[model samples]
Target: MTEETAPQDGPDGPDGPDGPDGRAARPDREGGAQAARPAGPAGDPGDAGARRGGRWRRPGPQQVPQPHPAAKGMWRGDAGGPFAQMTVMPGRMSVRLRLTLLYGLLFFMAGALLLFVMSVLMANILGNVKVIGFGISDAEAAELQRQFVEQTMRQLVGRSLLALGGVGVITLVLGWFVADRALSPLQRVTTTARRLSESTLHERIALEGPDDEIKELADTFDAMLERLGQAFDTQRRFVANASHELRTPLAINRTLLEVALGDPEASDDLRAVGRTLLATNARHERLIEGLLLLARSERELTARTPVDLAEVAATVLEHSARREHDNDVAVHPELTPGTALGDPVLLEHLVSNLVENAIKHNAEDGGELWIRTGMLEGYATVQVENTGPVVPAYEVERLFEPFRRLNADRVESAKGAGLGLSIVRSVVLAHRGAVYAVPRPGGGLIVTVRLPPGQPAA
Candidate 1:
């Protein structure tokens, strides 16, 4: 048989083609032709492929149905079905509001139950009254008495409902006030906790009132702050002591290395070794200084002066000019008046570190460096963007950590100490500002620093 009309291989082999019911094919009235098989259920084309012993496959990419515009803010289920739309979740209710509503509901329910009881009692009392016959028959007098009792009870229930409604409204207002008053101490605690930082940890809630749960909580918070302050104080001392102890040896070693390298009688090999030792000593010194600066910047700033960011950036640029030239990097500066409240020295260091990092991490060949400083959104801002090796977005955050570098060992890398970004973050945080870095679209990083605006010098 030709390939087009060939009997395809079946699970039962080509000799015996099975029908839909797994029975052997039967011959038609013509005797030579097979009987026509029924189409697969639901007329799915895949069933024909399955009957031919071929794997079924989708013709095109599956499409996902979009939710109806009216169903916005609501969850959707399967497409074009009865359960397509689901109810939107309700917004959160504050504890104070929830408490007030609960109180009013309970009071209103109790009032309703009391009113119901009173109506029952009144009905029974009125029903038992005996009617005296003055001018009518006993039956007529009884009917009049019944009408009188019904009217009196109607008036009683109507007045009572009105009074209960008014009382419920008043209770709701009272409950709201009570909830606010009760939660005031907690609000104080929250505010204090948010405002306190490493520098302001000495401030305490000191909530003074009748001893209650909230008061106890406030006292516990204050005690915790006390311990934190002590720990921070200890840390500050340790950093200071470590800085002093570490600097002396590094400084002495550098002086000795310089003295040895200066000797004219030294052989070329000895001089080369001395120069290498000097470089290593200088790297150690830089490391120590970076560590000390990082620690200091993590602490709270004790002094604040109005420092112009433009001036700081300009100064750092001037100092970094030689390095930029050496690296064959172009400088672009758009300095504007960006004044921030911070220590002048620390602010300068922050700017210097950013500039140095941009230059150091720039492309090996000539690259572009862009620096901008101005007031943005009521805050002084400094932004630095540069062209360099492509930095992964995921690795951007890790660069701020001490001794972290992308694809380079901290000790082996000539890049200074890997503490530049870490110190920048610490200084920004200490000034109650924010600093963040994102990978540039093409290459390098875009680092931005925002600080509180300071009043211009008069």
Candidate 2:
């Protein structure tokens, strides 16, 4: 038997028209009348009417209110912002004053309320009494009644006010004591915070009291400090490990490159490449050394030695004399005894880097390098100036940042890894010293460093 295939109910069905559901469709939308859809509710989604109709929803959580900017500054007692300079004057409303005023006001209000009740009762009792039994004229009886009521009220009010005044004085004295007690915990918190620093991180608030909000705050602060101490310790360990791990390989590479370059039978091309590689390797070593030194110098000094700033400057100049001569830079040293307490090696590095930087970036011909050291205002001071490209006053600050240089184009030989000033800053900070640089009027820089005076040399 011949099998007749039934028409599939698809877009092109036996019904002749195709639709999205594969059934007979209406005429093409552009050519035919379309069915109208029922209209939706009137207002836009977030409009007031929609909200009133319960069509718009609100967030499940109510947002917490933030303190006003003015209120924040007022609470912080900042130098500016609303209420920062406000006082309850005519009279100053200190915490104690405010508490005292509150106590007095409440006592006065209670006394006034009691007096009002007594006055009302007296008036009611007098008002209800009849005057016929006294045998006096109506006018006279009325006059007598009036005088009696007036005298009674005057005495009542006067005595009640006097008692209120006396109570108010007593309440004020008590309020002062109460206010002081209430603020004692806050005072403790302030004292603890003032005494805490990086060096004293082991100390804690240890607020011994009930589990109140202030106690909780103190505990949180202590926990934060503990975490900070741990983080700092970890960082120191990481820097030490990295210095050891990275320096060993760099030293080995330098040794290998040097041995290879030393071969007499090596080809010229090979020798040239070896020399370049060795130079690059040496630059990497200097960079690593600079980073390690910078990290070490940022930490608190554990041991200090008496180091003479003038001697350090003189030694650095002596070492750099050959470079200065080759670069056509004249070294002018004005050294005086300026002793500082710090790590001797780090101080030496600080001096050498400053001097080297001055030489490196000096004028191409007849550059003048001046290094001066002496005591300035009880500080061991070292000042270095060089004749080089002009430096802008604004860019002086950025020079102390790691890998930051005046010219964006970085030539390693010219800039020397851009860490000289940064390392100097770190060392200065480690020794509790200050370093600042100012651009000279012509074309150069005058960098000054002042270190705290050290103990007398033994």
Candidate 3:
């Protein structure tokens, strides 16, 4: 017997030695093998290939495909698809209103269903009643009975519908009241949370009610506040104690350095070393002071009085005049009446830091500085603009962080410790105000501060 060879199936299974579509593979002009498909009814080779392979094919220039009726509202950019449209609500409907409406709708539906059932039963019962008439034809009596049943049903349905409408209105009103009462506890929680901050962490919800979900949430919030208050208190005490302990040693060192430098017979090298040590000591003292001020500003102000921002800015400018002249920076002030409620010392510090920062970071020669203080939109406003090297917009916000400066390598900086802007921000926040900075157009920065307006001090 002759050796039998089993035929191997093509990749698509049990097909002849051809392409997946059962057509012989032919080499194209590009020397690539492709299936040779017969033309379809439209006599287009591409169409035939698409049909044979069961795949989507782009329409030719002469052919345009019509959209199906079902796809009329689908994939539209302006109107959006059905699923996207379904997610859009008609307007701003609060949860409480939605619940109330839902309750009223359910009641209305139940009432309508009950009316329908009663009407049907009444009609069946009236239809079964035998018509009893004296001295009248049975057919006439039956017609009269039919008319009476129709009239009675009409009156009953009308009255029932009217009653349902009145009851639905009352139901909506009651539902609204109930929803408001139900959500009142949540509203309290929200209000307390909004009013509480780092300074007011001692405030608690202390909501008194049955141990339900809302009460549980309020209790949890109160517990969080208690823990936060403890943490903040501990932090404040540590900072105060550390600063006090450090001040004594620094003060002693400064006194010793001054005495050593004042010695008449001291060698030149010894004198130079003493002066350097004194400068270093002064810098350390300034750093400590900055830290203490920062801690104080981050806490709630215990005392507040009307402080004129324009007067504060004028004082700062007077003190900064020598520094500005030495740096070859020009100061332009536009001070008008702008009073705010805050601690005078902290507000002065805020203005001083801003003015010093502006002068220190100014251009080498003839840098211009502008300081404006006035009432703006019912808020006391102070704005400072200066000329200096270009500051990137992305780095503006980081300047408010403690120990952060425009230059990454700040250790060797002769400028005061990198706490100027940080202190300013703290003071602004302590006063419940806002401060922001933006990069100047050509090169430099513009810092603006807005505080709650206060009455002039009498």
What is the lDDT for 141 in model 2? 78
lDDT for model 3 comes to: 0.68
lDDT of 3 by residue, 67-180 (tens): 212112221111121111222234778889999999999999999999999999999998988889899999999999999999999999999999999999999999999999
Greater-TM-score candidate between 1 and 2 = 1
Compute the lDDT for candidate 1.
Answer: 0.69
- Candidate 2 Cα outliers beyond 4 Å, as residue runs: 1-200, 303-306, 322-327, 409-411
lDDT (0 to 1) per candidate: 0.69, 0.64, 0.68
- Ten residues in sequence with the least summed lDDT for candidate 3: 22-31
1 against 2, candidate with superior lDDT: 1
Q: Over the stretch 1-458, how does candidate 2's per-residue lDDT look in tens digits?
A: 12111122244321222211111111111101121111112321112212232110111122111111111111111123111232233444676668767877887888789889988998888766655536778998777777777887789788878987887788888888887787677767766664554566688778887898878888888898899889878988999899989999999999999899889999999999998898788888888988998888887666677888878988888788666343578877767666777789999999999998888788887889877665543445677878899887677777888898886536375467888988987787666555656665457776766565676587
Each prediction's TM-score versus the true structure = 0.73, 0.62, 0.71
The CA lDDT at 61 in model 2 is 20
Error of 1 at 390 (Å): 1.0
Clashing pairs in 1: none
* Model 3 misplaced stretches (Cα beyond 4 Å): 1-96, 123-150, 190-204, 322-327
The true-versus-predicted C-alpha distance at residue 330 of model 1, in Å, is 1.7
